[model samples]
Target: EPEVTQTPSHQVTQMGQEVILRCVPISNHLYFYWYRQILGQKVEFLVSFYNNEISEKSEIFDDQFSVERPDGSNFTLKIRSTKLEDSAMYFCASSRTGNSGNTIYFGEGSWLTVV
Candidate 1:
């Protein structure tokens, strides 16, 4: 089965540096999403995209964050300025259904560490 894959399995950034996490979603999937789990917290949705535009986004996806599908299979999430609080395990997910309404599969996660 095809699965989502993330690059730079781990990342360490300075408090205000920019960071971009990359993912290759399933080939046939139509919806893509970003979610974060802050250490012991529950997984939280960040944003969802489809058809080249954002379909849904959470409050956590503020001015500092953006997402793009620059290629057929590649999806990326960029944080313009990282904060210490931004340290979390960022998971990229995809599904055949639309945003916020599908049982998406997640990557192992890209761990972001900011200090």
Candidate 2:
């Protein structure tokens, strides 16, 4: 079995600063995604990447946000500018299939805190 792993388990940043959350998904998986959960809030989808491009994205993934697979082995999400409302536990995930009925697995998560 394989799993997604995220780095810098926790981070705190200034309101206008940028932050990049990193992740390494299961090697064989083809679909990777970024999701987040604000404290006391439900988890929400951010973006999904496949075949080296964005396959899907939620409205929450605005110009201020971007994602990339810098290398064949790792995936990353960059927040152009942090906002107090951006504080949340960001999760990296992967799936063998991206079908609606299929399941996607998640990493432990990277907690982002903004002031």
Candidate 3:
């Protein structure tokens, strides 16, 4: 079966530099989302996108963050400026639709480590 794939399973970055996490969501899905787990915190939704533009974004998705589908299969999240608090496991998920019954598939996660 096809699955979501994330790159650089772990990353070490400076506190003020930029970072881009990459993901390839499952094909045939229309809705894509980015979520982050800050060490012991709950998974926080950052943004949801479909049909090219953002459909919904949480307060966590501030001016420093952006996302794009660079190609048919690649979706990337860019953090303009990183912080120590930005270290977390970034997960990429995709669902065929927005319905509750649709189970979203998540990557193993890209672990971001900032210092």
Looking at candidate 1, the ten consecutive residues that score lowest on lDDT are 95-104
TM per model?
0.95, 0.95, 0.96
Give one digit per residue, the lDDT tens place, for model 1 in 10-82: 9999999999999999999999999999999999999999999999999999989999999898999999879
Show the colliding residue pairs in model 3: none
Q: Name the TM-score of candidate 3.
A: 0.96
Per-residue accuracy of model 2 over 63-84 as CA lDDT, tens digit each: 9999999999999999987899
Residue 103's lDDT within candidate 3 is 93
After TM-score superposition, what is the CA distance of residue 93 in candidate 1 from its true location, in Å?
Answer: 0.2
The lDDT values for all models are 0.94, 0.94, 0.94
lDDT of 1 at 84: 95
Worst 10 residues of 2 by lDDT: 96-105
lDDT of 3 by residue, 1-115 (tens): 9899999799999989999999999999989999999998999999999989899999999999999998999888999789999999999999999899999999999999999
- The order of the candidates by TM-score, greatest first, is 3, 2, 1
